[model samples]
Target: MDVFDHDAGGISGRRPLVEIEEGAGFPDGLTVDAEGCVWVALWDGGAVRRYTPAGELDRVVTLPTPRTTACAFGGPGLTDLYVTTARTGLASPHPLSGSLLVVPGAGKGLPQPAFEG
Candidate 1:
């Protein structure tokens, strides 16, 4: 995927970021942590990957289902990673598919900043 810098003039430029391998599932949703690392949900890959700001893969958290769609940090300390998954188009039923999963102590997430615009 490409990361763009937004400015008064609109998107200033694009920088090539993480590229998923051919067989890896598509990236569905993502969130950036307070430390500036990116947590990405891998659709059909059954995992979440944490990448450094420089687009380097740092860690991976595997899930029971292969249809993980999105993730976000919640909980009192914002250190819980809540993930969402899908069950549509699955040839067989998956126990965890279409369920919400939470991983505690994943990492602290930054509060979404307010936009003046």
Candidate 2:
């Protein structure tokens, strides 16, 4: 993803943060950890990848099914990775397709901000 300069409506200073190969599936859902690292789900790649703030590949977590759609942190400590999958458009879906797969001890999530409006 590209990081845009946070000035003038973020219309300038666009820079590449990371690049994923076309053959390595598309980058789908993404979230930032409390430590400022990025967690990205690879759609049709059957895996999740973590990258450091400096755009370095830090970790990879493979799933039983492809079509990984989205991810988020949950559980008591916010360290559990809740991954959502999709079975749409598949002739024969995997057993775990369209399931909420949770990976324990994935990472800590940012504290949720309150909004009342």
Candidate 3:
């Protein structure tokens, strides 16, 4: 996966600031924290990885299910990390597969901005 920097003109010309190898499992979804760290959900890897703004791996949180799909921060002060998983391809589903997990005190996250159309 790659994160890019757009030029002043537009997205027509841009360069990727971070390029992660495909061997690192598919990145399904991600969210940026208040500290500018990125939390990424790994599908088929059963884990979520936190990456620093410099593209360095900071931390990893593993889940019981391999099909972890998405994640977000919620609850009071956005100090909780909520993860979502899937059981679509599991031969023997894990007890928590396809469930919503609330991990308290994961880290502080920035509140999502409301769309202004």
Candidate 4:
């Protein structure tokens, strides 16, 4: 994936920021944490990975159900992870397929900033 220079008020350019390993499943939903680390959901891989801002793989959270489609941080303290999965094409899906899973104490999420636009 790449991060682009967008502070100029236009689509300036982009530079490589990270590379997902081969066979690590297609990169799906992702969000930046409070620490600027990236949390990505891996489709067909049954896992969520956390990468440092420098693009280094730092942590992985595995799930019993495959086809993880998206993830986000939620909960009162914002230290919980809410994961979404899919079971549309699976011949036999896990019991938790398509259910929302919560990972407690994952990490703090970036606070939403007020839009000035």
Candidate 5:
């Protein structure tokens, strides 16, 4: 498994092929675009950050709730993004977690091939 430092605080030291930028947050889910941009969903931070292929900060998208679980590219043209969020904490007041979200995405998504065996 490959590991990248994305703490974004003052944590120093180089590890492997990945390096985190300054002031970034904890990342939970991640997806790569056709242009090689990385979109990371912050677990507790309640937002997503887009990074360039070279590790530069590009853009950020905010979410309505906290605890984004995962993300992926879907649809026929792959121009749509699907985000999954979790509502881990609750006493049964309202339907919170385990919800699906769809949003507009940039560029085209390649078809995912089925793994053989």
Candidate 6:
């Protein structure tokens, strides 16, 4: 968990911004693409969500596994997306909850902006 401290002009300590449902799982991993789109890996929900800068749901990518862990954009020009997942618990009529995934996307992701002084 990482957070920005506006007053300090640097990244601050960990802070809980949003809490997922109990047992539903927390947000696994996240990354901001070159286009400024935020891609988040949803645990248990088995999907990745791409959000616009305005906090709108631009796209949702479903996964074959049930636990989508983290996501990032990589490859030439940052045009490819890579995702990771965890299969901690799966069996006994439960859904598969762990695996890594990838998908082709449009636009290359940009580097994150540095904290202002």
TM-score for each model: 0.91, 0.90, 0.85, 0.90, 0.69, 0.68
The candidate that achieves the highest TM-score relative to the unseen native structure: 1
Candidate 4 lDDT score at position 12: 63
Residue by residue across 34-114, what tens digits does model 1's lDDT show? 999889999989999999989999989999999999999999889999999999999995888999999999999878767
For candidate 3, the TM-score is: 0.85
The residue pairs found clashing in candidate 6 are 33-110, 34-109, 34-110, 86-98, 87-98
Question: How well is each residue in 1-117 modelled by candidate 4, as lDDT tens digits?
Answer: 787777657876778878877888888999889999999999988999999988898999999989999999989878999999999899999999999999999999976766999
* Local accuracy of candidate 6 as per-residue lDDT tens digits, 35-111: 66677888787777777765667887877777788887777777877878777766632343444466876446775
Instruction: State the TM-score for model 2.
Output: 0.90
**Candidate 1 residue spans exceeding 4 A from truth:** 113-117
Native-to-model Cα distance after best TM-score fit, residue 77 in candidate 4, in Å? 1.1
Worst 10 residues of 1 by lDDT: 7-16
TM-score between model 5 and native: 0.69
Cand. 6 TM to true fold: 0.68
Model 2 C-alpha lDDT per residue in residues 1-117, reported as the tens digit of each score: 777668656577789989997877789998899999889999999989999989999999999888998888989989999999999888889999999999999999876777977
Candidate 4 lDDT (Cα, 0 to 1): 0.90
Question: Runs in model 4 with CA error above 4 Å?
Answer: 113-117
